[model samples]
Each structure stands twice: as C-alpha cells, then as structure tokens.
Target: MLDKLRREFTLITFGLSGVVLLIALVMTFVSNVTMQNNVTLSLLNRGLEVGHALNPQMGSKDREGTVGADSMLTVSVDVTPSGIVLNKSESPVGLDEDALDEIVAKAVSGSETSGTNWARHLAWAKKSTVYGLRIAICDTYSRDVSLIRQGISGVIIFLMSLCALYAVSRALANRSIKPVSEAWDAQRRFISDASHELKTPLAVILANVQILQRSKDMSAEDMRWVGRTADEAEHMKGLVEDLLTLARADEAKAGSVGAAGPMVELDLSEIVDECALEFDAVAFERGCTISCETEPEVMVTGDKQQLERVMNTLVDNATKYAAKDSEVKLSARRDGKKAHVTVNNKGAVIDAEDLAHLFDRFYRTDKARSREETGGFGLGLAIAKSIVDAHGGKIWATSDAASGTTFHVTL
Candidate 1:
C-alpha cells in the first residue's frame, strides 16, 4: 500500500490531502479558542454587573433588591452579620461557602473579585435584593474542552475520507495518462527497430549500384536510370541514418546529461577550418565562395565527430541554396565559457514561419524546389540539431530582407 501511494499521482494526492487537513485543523483550533475566550469574558462582565446593581458604592453592606424578586433565576441572596449579600450561584449547586466568604470580604475591602476560572470569583454586595452574579467555570470549561475534542475527531475523520478520495482520484488520473506513456514507448521502439532494419538492405543496394555503375558497356539511358535509382536509395539510407541518430541523441540526453562522461576536449576552430577547406571544391563547383573567419583557439568539450557533422550540414545547406558566386561565411569563436559557431550566406530569405520548422525532420521551406533542385530529403539541419543537442548546444536561424539568412550555433 505504501509503495503504491509513492507513485507520482498518488503522492500528489496525498500532498493535497495533507494541506486540506492542516487548514481544517488550524481553523478548528482558532475558532474553539476564540469562542472559549469570549465566553469567559462575558461571564466576567455579568458578575461585575450584578455587583454594581447591589451596591453602586460596593464597599458598604447594603441590599437594594430582593434576590428572587430581581427576575434573574441564577441570582442568590445571603444575609450575614457584616452585610446583606447578593451573589449569583456559580452553578445550580450554589457557591462554595469558603470561596463566597473570601469574595464577600474582598468586595467589602473595596477590591474587584478576580480569579482564574469564571465560577470561582462570585461577585456580591449589600443591595435591596442581596443579588449577585457568577457563571459556572466547570460546565463552560468542560463544554469547550468537549467541543475541541469533537472538532479534532471530526477533522481526523474528514482527513481520512479525503485521503481515500485522493487515492481514487490518483488512480483515475494515472489511467488517463497511461495511454500517452504507452504510445510514446511504442513510437520510440518503432523508430529504433525500423532504423536497424533498413540499414543492411540499403548497404547492399548501394554496393550493387556502385558495381553496376562501373560496367563499361552500360547504355546512356540505362546509366541515367541507374544513377537515379542509386540516388534515391542513398537518400532513403540517409533518412534512416538520421532517424537512428535522433534516437541515440534522445537516449544519451535522457541517461547521461550533466554526467559528461563521454565528452572530450577539442578545438572547434580547427575542426571548422578543416571542414571549410574540404568543402572548398564543392563550393567552387557551385560557383560559390566559401570563407572562414575563425578565432585561433576556441576549445569545447563534446563529441568531435558530431561537432564535425554540425559544421558539414551548415556548409552543405549554404552550398545547395545560396545564390551563385555568393559568399558563405563560416565563423567560430569562444564567447565566455561557450563556443559559438555561425554560418552566414547571402541567399534568398528563409520565411519566418518556415525557419521555426526547418530543424524538424523532413521539413523544408519549399518542398517542391527542395525535391527538384537539391535531391535533399530535408533532414540535414534536423540531424545537425540532434548532434548539437547531444553536445548540449543550441542552433537557430535568423533572416531578413537585407542580410539574407544566418544560422547560429552556440555550445
């Protein structure tokens, strides 16, 4: 039972129930204390009123009214050698004789009758009726005590009932969220299995296509179809690879974030320069100029290969889409404890709405142009994002009518 209640939903319910129970207990205690104090004060005032009526100047022995004739049932009369005393009965049992004597003596001596319990200090003076007043301390005190005990017991019962209700609510909430959890697990497993399943067949096809392309006697028409088929196969292969990479990145982040066990120190500036040099030929083929403005020594702790992939994707995107002969700048530097890498290009402005969705898998700005112009499945930035995320980095794109588009990566 304890273990079951330790689950997230149950624990939340238990916490809420505890809070409600605490509020109830506080209110009950405060209200009971206030009521008891008020009743004690009212009894004291009544005793003082009776003393006043009996003797306006309380020190003298004088009786102004008969006790029973005063029309107050609780009032009592006492005749003594010193005075005709009027006092209220402390209870139906009347006053304690010794306590009455002390009270009478105090009243004659010109002192107020004051004591701890309400019934103990009975007020009296010599009046026409010899009437005095007091309230029963035991009855008032016992009733207040009983009420407080009953209130506590009621609170306990209410808390127990709330706890049971909370248990039921928690179970219902868990059942409602269970489907989302199951679907999430199923989706993760499907991606993991599908990526593994597709790789071997893709490798075999690529191998066979390469062998066929080398044949000396193949017709031009046949070569064209073969090339198209091989390209499509490779695109599919890259998609599967990207999916696997995203899956792995998710697993790594979930399990090992902040542990930094697999991280290594590497010079980001050197890696960016190396990739720029390698992509120079491709840039030249596309009639584009690739330039690097690198800070000499920017060190970062991450997976070197993944960081290399991030640089490669940004360069490839620039090469594919940037206008002919337009400058594509790759820059890297150290900013505080973080390394910043930026790829800027003078190209057609990317749409603001499309920019947000650009890093989503298989998403593209212009899907028709993407399909026809670049032979891209639109997973490059998505893969780059996954890789950067695995290294605890952020990547975003900004564009305007004036400056074209720039993708900034901060690690």
Candidate 2:
C-alpha cells in the first residue's frame, strides 16, 4: 500500500511538471518563431525597398519615399540576354567579385536568386526585366540574425532548465510521500496495539458476565442485564478483531506477499457456492431467493477462513438488503488469470455519493440506515478490502436504480 501510494505521488508530481513545462516550452518556442519571422520579414522588406529605390522607372517621389527606410548596403546588377552583367549601381560596400558572379549566374540561368549566406549574414533577391534580363539585389543583415541567434540560444537554455526541473521534481516526489507513508505505518501500528490491548479486557468482561448469568442467586432482571453485557462485549470483540486483522494486512511487506504461513490455496468457486446456499435459507426467510452461478475449479491462493468471511459478509449483507420477493445473485468465475466474485441484490439503489464511501470503515449509507433492525458496524466491506489487499486483489461496488447494488471482487 505504501509503495502504491508512493508510485501515485511520483506519477502526479512528474506528470504535472512535464505538462506544465512542456506548455511553457511550446509558448516560448512559438513566440520565438513569431519574433524571428517578424525580423526576417523586415530584412526582406528592407531589401525590397532598396530594390524599388533603384528601379529604372521609379519617380523622384518613390526614391525619396524609399530613402532612410533601409540603410543596409545593396548592389543591383542587370544580367543581359547574353548572360553578361550590366552593373546598374553599387552601394558603398559593394559585393565582392565572386559573390557578384554567383548571384548573376543564378539569375541568368533562371534559378532561384533569393537566399542568405550563413557565413556573412547576407540576404539576396532578384527580379526579371522585360527584355529577357534580370536585376538581382543583395544586402547584409548581420545584427538582426545575430539577435535571432541569441534568442534561439535562450530557448535552448530554457529547454535545458526544464529537463533539470523534471529531474528535481522526481527527487522531490520521492521525499513528499515519506511523511504520509510514515504516518500511515504509525496508524496501522496504533490500531494493532490498541486492538491487542482491548482483547483481554473484552474477554474478561464476557467471562464474568457468563459467570454472573449462571449463578442461581441472580434474578431474571439481573440475568437479562448480564446477557446484554455479554452481547455487547462480544460485539466489541468482533470490532477489535476486525481492526487487528486490517492492521496485520496493512503491515504486510511491500512485495513479500504470501510470506505469512496461515494462507493456503483456496477454491474460490466452492466458497461462493457454499455462501450462496447458506444465505439462500436466510433470504428465503426474508421472502427473497439467492441464485448462484459459479465456474468450476476457480482458484486463488489466500486464507480460506478470511476469504470465507468475505463471502459470508457479502452474502449476509445482500440477503439482508434485497427487496422482498426479489432475487439475490452470487457469481464466481475465472476472468483472465484472476478470480472474480460478484454479489448483486435487487433492492434500494445506493446513491452515487454513498457508493464512494461504501467500503469505508464505520460508514453507513442512508439506505443502510433505513434497515436498522439488521444493523451492522459497517466494517464488513472494509475488512473484506483488507483481506483482498493481502491477497493482491481488488474490490469495488457499483449501483443504479435499474440494477440495484453490486459488490465485485477480483482475486
């Protein structure tokens, strides 16, 4: 149980951390891409403006409008029909001869003439002229790409930080479950000790009441009081035993199941059938019937007496709660590698909210309260859960207006 709780804690911590960090990383990358696109588009627009400023047909106003919009150096070259360059204008920082040759060759050959060089942070663009010629333009934008590179670096660092946080989160998750695990262990120990301490007093009280009832000197009224004391002491004894059983189950080691010598291989199908038959008579007295459907040879490794108690408790509860003249069904079958037992009664539907606490210790639902004559201490299901846990199994309940209530167990 402690291991299961620890695993749950680890998953919750790491799962939340991963989801939150991933979202932050995605937002950061998205914003970074947006900013980079804006910067790149600005560089391309500046190159286009420079190209338009040197356009042959541009009026003076167009040139004036283009001025001061972009201060990046640019060169415009026209490639003629014979693939010879007609240099139109050169910026103060003119393109190197090799670079000019590369751009002219691409434009004249009708290939893509717009791109950037990583080594120099230069951007280039080209446009075709009317007489089978082309004008190519190039410029430098080192500062803009440099800023983008730094922004990308920051994103990388952010991603690395998330990794570190994930690692730390796992460590914290381990530590976070420690106090809860320790407190739970302490609770189990306390219950075990208290139950053990109460057993002797309860036994002594019951023995004394039995002695008082047997004495010829006692009147009928005195005998009645002794009987009541005996009955109440027995009831308290059962409660103490239940608490001790649960404490023992909880104290089972993390992975060393079946370590206790008391458990043996049990025929689950036989137990269910016997409980159903036993309860059939009880149900018949209450104007109800028990119908059993058990698969042959269904088996589990568990304490037979404890498992029998679980089945008996479930059958008794079902028989008690089933509506008059309604049917209570008990079933046992092998489901995959596990044994499944189900007890279903046609009766009052348990509320959705009550179903959640149905197995909780001392929890009586509103419907259970209505049948006070057949009152229970409300620890039967809880004891069954502890036994199921000891056997490495699961138990749950479901209900609805149409189907009544069903208690299901897997072993």
- The models' CA-based lDDT, in order, is 0.70, 0.74
* Model 2: per-residue Cα lDDT over 43-118, one tens digit each: 4555444553454332323443643324345555556776687555535545677777766666667576466665
Q: Compared to the true structure, candidate 1 yields what TM-score?
A: 0.57
lDDT for model 1: 0.70
Q: Write the per-residue lDDT of candidate 1 for residues 16-113, one digit (tens) a residue.
A: 87777778777877787787656655544443444424422323333533333112312333434354454333334344667656655554454444
**TM-score of structure candidate 2:** 0.73
- The root-mean-square deviation over C-alpha atoms between each candidate and the true structure, in angstroms, is 10.5, 6.7
What's the lDDT for residue 52 in model 2? Answer: 33
* Reference-based lDDT, residue 221, model 1: 97
Off by more than 4 A, model 2: 1-20, 52-163, 174-179, 253-264, 367-372
* Number of the top-ranking candidate, with lDDT as the measure: 2
